[model samples]
Target chain A: MRVAFCFDLDGTLTEEEILPQIAKHVDLYEEIELLTKITMRGLITFSKSFKLRVRLLSTIPIPTVKQTVNTILVNRPLQEFVRNNKSDCFIVTGNLDVWVDEFISREYGCAYFSSRAKVEGDKLIDIEKILDKQEAIHTLRNSYDLIVAVGDGMNDCSMLEQADIGIAFGGVHEPVSTLINIADYVCYDGLALAVLLKSLKQKYGREN
Target chain B: MAGKIDTVIICAAGLGSRLGLDMPKCLVEIGGHPLIYYLLNVLYDVPNIRMVVGFKEDIVMDCVRKIRKDVVFVRNPAYTTTTNSYSLYLGSHDLQVPFLNIDGDMYISRDNYEKFVDKIVPGEDLIGVTLSYTEDAVNVLLDSENRAIGFSREKISNYEWTGIAYLANIKIRKEGLYIYQELEAYLPIQTEEISCFEIDTPQDLEYLSNKMGHL
Candidate 1:
């Protein structure tokens, strides 16, 4: 049976959140950061907080947003591992595809499922729809025997709960309590996470 | 990023008095092979292997050398006066990276060994445990977080601490004390439950010998 390895983008894959970086360009970093914290802590709905943050940064130029995202560092070891096992890996995020597609999809060459954005010719506009992470895992379940989800925030709880194995990552931010409560394993470093993924693949990858 | 654990310290300095053997405990034959044979075979992937030998060190070294020639031997000359704690301290007193610490007397299945290795998460210290317990087993008590809160010989909890642990660092202020006592100070220590058996008595040897007969 084939296994699907799903990763949360914002704080799990990238060292920092991209929205806050974009907010830096528009002088709204503090406000967006506060909202991000609230959303990550499960104090507010991610869908609501995400829409508000995007609206606050809607006036920023597309080029500046691109440059801001380009400066964000990818978790190098995790990226390398995902690159090596691209056949079964995915990036599942609530971030807009327009903002993250260039780097995550184009450069890293990994498949992704993210919130759709409504853009008007080089200028930011609004979020068209938010991707339900749990639904994403359910869709992948049709083809994969085991789905392992890795994330570190409240928004990732559903995805983690729905997967065969859930790993709460603390490499960037300490995993939120809600996510930790549901995770089968909590990993604090990339090597440990990589080792776990490899072991799972080795154990269940050949069973079916 | 974390690195793979490459070093393993095996404490094999005990005398097999309970088994009524005159040789080192690690050299006792279990199913036509020494106890170290099964241990070394299970740990072959680790790059660095260190063993603490005493109580007929020459014979133990000669026997172990036939299995794996690359092992570095650390001698505990005061094997009569010291316990396994001293042997463990002598084996891993100066190391920076995390390494696995395993007792030499354990007889574990290959599946259980692989499961134990898979349960290891880098950056978190772990103590391998089993749900099955005996009256003489050193049982462990865990909090909600699965951290070892207490350890005792009595049936204090449902989990028994197998003599297997992964230490994140080798720097210790109390070298003479038992490893679990030294580690208890660093609370919230993680635990992993795996199938394992320790060959400590004549009955244990008989039980394992009979168990292996079915295979």
Candidate 2:
């Protein structure tokens, strides 16, 4: 049986949120951070919050955003685990592909389903489509027998709930209570998370 | 089996009326720490742990959250009228992998506990037994193969039940039955010698307190 590992990009794969890092460059860090917190707590809807946060960040130069994305630290152990198991790993994020594509997709060369952004010749424009994480999981479920999802925010609730094994990661931020409630396992350290993923792979990976 | 023992269903929903404690038995302090603290510390290698809480669940959950934020809790609302079997049933009802079923009232030396964990082989069901005698101990009758054929409140055999077991994936038929009674249906249970004790009365608590300095 095939098994897939789904990861959330922002809080699960990176130490910082991509949008907040971009917000710092445009001097809207505090405001965007508040919005991010509210959205993560499920106080506000994810689609509305994503549009608002993207609108706040759209004015920044594309090069500046790319440079900041490069500077944002990836969770090294998780990156290594995904790299070793790239065939069955997928990044499911609500972040725009135009912003994170270079660092996350191109750097790792891993498959991802992310929000699409309409870019008009090097100028940041508008969101073309917001990726529904649950839908992505459903699509992967057709091929894989078991899906293990890891995330920390409220936007990840649906994907986590849909997965066979849901792990609420608190490596970047303390996972919201809603996500934790649905998670089968909760991990606080990146190394521990990596170990858990490896153990799960041994247990459910197709080769096993 | 799909995996090694990755989950532990700790039945902490019982009300320890004999111990004269206002809190649940799992929350009773041995030496400034809850009884679960030692068990969880030793079980760090196991990835999934579900705690079934009922009487004073909030308090027990609070203590557990402080020690290990990863623990998942399943509340048994009928803790007042139910036995540990019901709480065990609630915890392991939906699990698909092998798990260790333990009572929250149990306290053992770290060395012996690690030995018990080491003895657990994948896909094999095991029950922990000890030669130590207690009037309330659940006695077991084992065949020559060391498979338990009978369990009784009276001294029916030389070994006493230790309230710990490693179970394979099997659905438990919960009909107000004790965990042992349900387990008896699946006879030929493998037995292991492990040093463990349960804190059910004031005397057990006092005995644990005396051993606390060594633990």
Candidate 3:
């Protein structure tokens, strides 16, 4: 059976939230953290909060954002798992593609879907496009027999709801209640998440 | 088919209302740590571990992740209306291999529990028997060979069922009988006596806490 393993970028893969780490670069950590918390709490819509967060963070040059994201640590076991199973892994994140592109490419070398950023030679201008996570799952539906999606944010609700198996991961932070209500499994650690994914992959044809 | 055991199924789904703690019994604190903490430590060497959680499952998972993160958790949403036997059934349904079943609310000595685990031989069923101590227990009736012949609640016996067993997946029946009662059809199974304490009431907790303090 063909299976696709989809993961959220910020808190699910990275040990810390990426945007907030980038916010630290421009002394706007508090603002970005507040936005992230409300977004995760479902107090604000993901699109609205994400757009505003990007506007606030766009002040930092593109190079600075990439550098900050590069310094952020990822969950080691998860990274290694994705690196080993590159053919079956996909990263689905709402973060700007311009910011995380280089870091994700170098670290994981896996296919990714991210919100787009309109840039003019090293300077951010406007949000070109916002990624709807469900679209990534829908796109992979034809090729895979099962889509297992993992995330820890309020924005992940749609993608998780659409996937064959939704995992509410809380390794770095608590998964929002809305996501938890729909998750097939709620995992709280990185190694545990990787192990679950491996098991699912192994048991796909036999007893899934 | 004797071989090394690969998996352990820990039943931690009960409300444990008898203790009146308003929390999952496994989360009950004994020596500054939850009871499940000690059990996880005892099974540290086992390769694959699964926990069945229901009452306050979020809290239990959070607590366990801090200690051991690799345990595969299975949710038993019917915990309120069911017993540990049902929890064991849910945990073992997908398992095609032999596994160790253990109660969540116990404080077992590491050395003694390890010895019991060492005696495990896959494809062969074994029941764990501990010294009789609790006010209420399912006593194990042993033959001259020290093998378990039957289980009784009212009969006086020197050893009580420890709620720990090593058996293949075929022994698990879907009936909601208590774990020991479920094993009645498979009686005359091998028995392993280990040093352990099960917390069922306030008295049991206090007694074991003091006993562990002196140990």
Candidate 4:
């Protein structure tokens, strides 16, 4: 059976949340914190919140954001799993493609889907599109027999719900209750998540 | 043949209403620590631990996570109408390996449990039986060879099913029967005597609390 493993980028893969790291690096801490409060209070949708964060973060040059993202630590075991299964792995994130493109390619060397950016040479620019995570699963469904999704945030809810198997990972923090309620399996440790990914792959991938 | 059984499936989804604690029985505090703490303390060596949770699962998951970060939480949404066998079935998903299945409410002697795990042989299923003591016990009818031929509640037997076993796979051919009743189809399976206490009622909890010194 052909299987696809989709991962959320921010808190799930990176040890530190990418946007927060970028915000802290460029001294946008207060602005980002206010936005986070609003987002947590459920005043805005994920797409809207992401777009707002991206637009606010656009003041920093694209290269600086990419550099900050690359400098952040990642869950090594999970990263290695994606590296080994590059062909079957994917990064489904709401972050702008322009910022993470270079970093993800350099780190994981796997296919990725993210929000589109209309960049004009490193200056603050307008938002083009915000990615809906479920779209990634829909696209992967056309090629793979089974889709296993892993994530830790509220935005990953639809993507996980659409996948054949959903795993709520708490490598950085506890998975939200909504995601946890629907997850097929919930894991806390990075090594355990990696092991679970391998086990699931073996079980479903061999059936075909 | 099986190698080492690395997976442990703990069924903690039941409402545990019979215990009248208004909480999952596994979370019941015995001597300050929850019942599951005793079992997990002994199962420290296991790498892949799957816990089937429902009926106040958030509480169970939160408590278990503090002790073991590697546990795989499997949701049993139909827990209200299902039995522990169904929870076992859910927990076994995607696992093609042999595993040790234990009920969540069992308080097993740590030393005895370690030895029981040590005695497990590859490719052979081992049933755990304790001395008949619970008010509503499923007694195991064993042959001279110590192989379980049938399970009976009416028959007076020395051993009662402790709801623990090292299984190759769970084959639920028949539905609605309790786990042991379903195991009748695979009769004459091997049995082992272990020192454990199953808390099913207030009396059982009190007995365990008083018998803690002896255990």
Candidate 5:
């Protein structure tokens, strides 16, 4: 089956976001807010904000994040979706390298595009945009016969609108109405997306 | 109320150190995914499940968390220092009504679970539901009244244990609560007029899985 499955990292596959996980360790709430405003005003790319956030949170302790993320990630249903369709899947997120590299990206063996983090001395630093998500989705729209994009949040709206099948995920944060309006389906559960894609592949997978 | 059984405490605290997995036994693979996933899926079908975790507790919780985020997780802080009954007692309070107890690593079939619970008379004080036992099972003896007499030894009894199910009444619920206050408390309680079923080791797990396949 020539299928492409793309997803939002934090809420789609995980119950919580990486930033909140970092926040649990580092008292970077004030600095994180500053980065959010900077990104909102287009002052810096998402990559920069991610880098700054991780760099600030680096002192919090790597083992804590590693152990916590491993605990948070291990048997997630969202990852099951990706695993069930490993060959055709990809992860598109604004999350950092430490999580994707350590937790999911390799385990599922799927291509993932996300903001890159700066790390030194076992400490994670700023994020630099490694893959512009919108651009990636827009490019993929023409590359595949059918595209399924699953994500939660306003930022995911652009990619969802560009895909043949758009699934608004509520596993993380709820998507904005505008984003939902553009999606073909909105499901509160991540497994529903997996089921939908599985059926889609079964029905049309063998068609020439 | 979140329904009759608002919560369920699955005793997954066993350190299956024999399996030699980096993660816990619950997180080991039976069907490409973790073994705990199978139990959790059938449990979620019940609509109310609170997982009881201890050994590699974080791993077990993390594994279950991805599948159902709203599930209640209670840790048996003294898991390594206790037994299955003790683990259940540690997190028993969250289950207010007659609760269904399950082993975290066993393979479960939804139809069997439904069939067993359906036999329970709605408001009756059914202490426990004991099924016939098979060889390689921890067997229970049934009296004339069908109350569990004691565990069998000389021969495999007429009934074999179906480790896969339970329908505990409130009295047993209270007993379960008090059973672990002292370590030896479990011994006499084990000899009480209690209903018994078996779910302790991998031999039973393989027997049930081979019998039931994946469900």
Candidate 6:
């Protein structure tokens, strides 16, 4: 059965969180710091933070950010495992347009939903069209048999709640308490996640 | 691990008394060259490899001292303590880490060894991975999922000795089971299928040679 698997990008896949990457890329050190503080305090939504942050990083060479994201995502050997178990899985994130579009298509063949980046001419615009991850999962439910969501940030809490099983990746980032408390399991790495999923499919899928 | 097993522990300390050999059977010449010399070169190419040694301590130490000496070594001074379990226990006590254990008497082509060793389950503690019903080998009991329920090297009426390898974690390596009991005391932990094996006689070597093309 196909389990719609939603994923958070920053701490879930890339070892480098998105804001840090934005901070390093655009040289907006002070803005990144302040934005991080607001996000940490739960004062600003991830959408607002992401849009405002990327707006600051709009001047970064698009190719450089895309390349960095691709490099980090592609080093993973999870492609074969995905192929072996692709009957179920999906990627859900709050990352902006070109980064998610190209990165997901090339590295992970699974369908993904991410925030759209407004572009003008050759430069990406600073503002992103924000879509909550929960909204992403809701859209996927029309086509999937089950949904399994994985993420860390507070922004991921709603999407995780929408899924059949939510997994919190505490190894990389401190997940929101709601996600942590409600998640079916918390995995340290892809290794643990894969093993758990394999066991789950065997025990609970189809015939059961 | 990308592969199944967390680590592969080659049992190399058995003294080759049958061959009238001065060195361990692992170090004995299979094709005019020491078997272990070939084994190490092949095993090291795989991701995670370890060694458990016992008899003729200096020889085992010296042979591995030069090449990739970083491998973990578990020594069994009581290698002759009436069972393979003793040697396995002594050598395995310190390794709280999970691993696979191979008998010293057998030989496998590099290709086959990788196929078996690389596919061993991670974190699961199992005694052996024996085969289907056959009187030729010790009838290894199997549960519904094919995990090993029991291992008896004696010619049993049921299961066949797979002659393959076994992957076990630190929990299974817990000291207590006498080698005489073999894998009898350790089979209740299976949450999934345990693969099996069948290597016990000189003829078995001939069989594998025929199967794997004389490695």
Best by TM-score: 4
lDDT, candidates in the order shown: 0.80, 0.83, 0.85, 0.84, 0.58, 0.58
Docking class of 2: incorrect
Give the alpha carbon lDDT tens digit for every residue of A1-208 in model 6.
6555567766676555655655676667676877865674467887778767777777877777777676564224334445565546666777777766777766667677777877776578655577688888889888877777777777888888888877766545455655655665544455545544554455445532
Candidate 2: residue pairs that collide: none
In candidate 4, list every pair of residues with a backbone clash.
A1-A208
The C-alpha stretches of model 3 lying farther than 4 A from their native spots are A59-64, A119-125, B1-7, B31-33, B44-49, B62-73, B89-98, B122-125, B131-160, B167-189, B206-210
Q: Per-candidate RMSD vs. true structure?
A: 18.8, 5.1, 4.0, 2.3, 18.8, 14.9
- What is the lDDT, from 0 to 100, of the residue A148 in candidate 1? 92
Can you give the DockQ of every candidate in the order shown?
Answer: 0.01, 0.10, 0.23, 0.72, 0.02, 0.01
Candidate with the greatest DockQ versus the true structure: 4
Q: Which of candidates 5 and 6 is the stronger one according to DockQ?
A: 5
**Tens digit of per-residue lDDT, candidate 4, span B88-163:** 8777767777888999998887677776777687877888988887757899988998888889887568889999
TM-score of 4: 0.94
Q: Which candidate number has the best lDDT? A: 3
**Candidate 6 global CA lDDT score:** 0.58
lDDT of 1 by residue, B1-215 (tens): 11365778888887867778788778878788988899899887786677877788767766876787657666676778878888887666545567888888887776887777777787778888998546677788999888888888778899988889888843445255676777777866788888888877888888887887777
- What are the runs in model 4 whose C-alpha is more than 4 Å off? A37-43, B1-5, B169-177, B213-215
lDDT score of residue B30 within candidate 5: 58
**Native contacts retained by candidate 2:** 0.07
Docking band of candidate 6: incorrect
Output the better candidate (1/6) by TM-score: 1
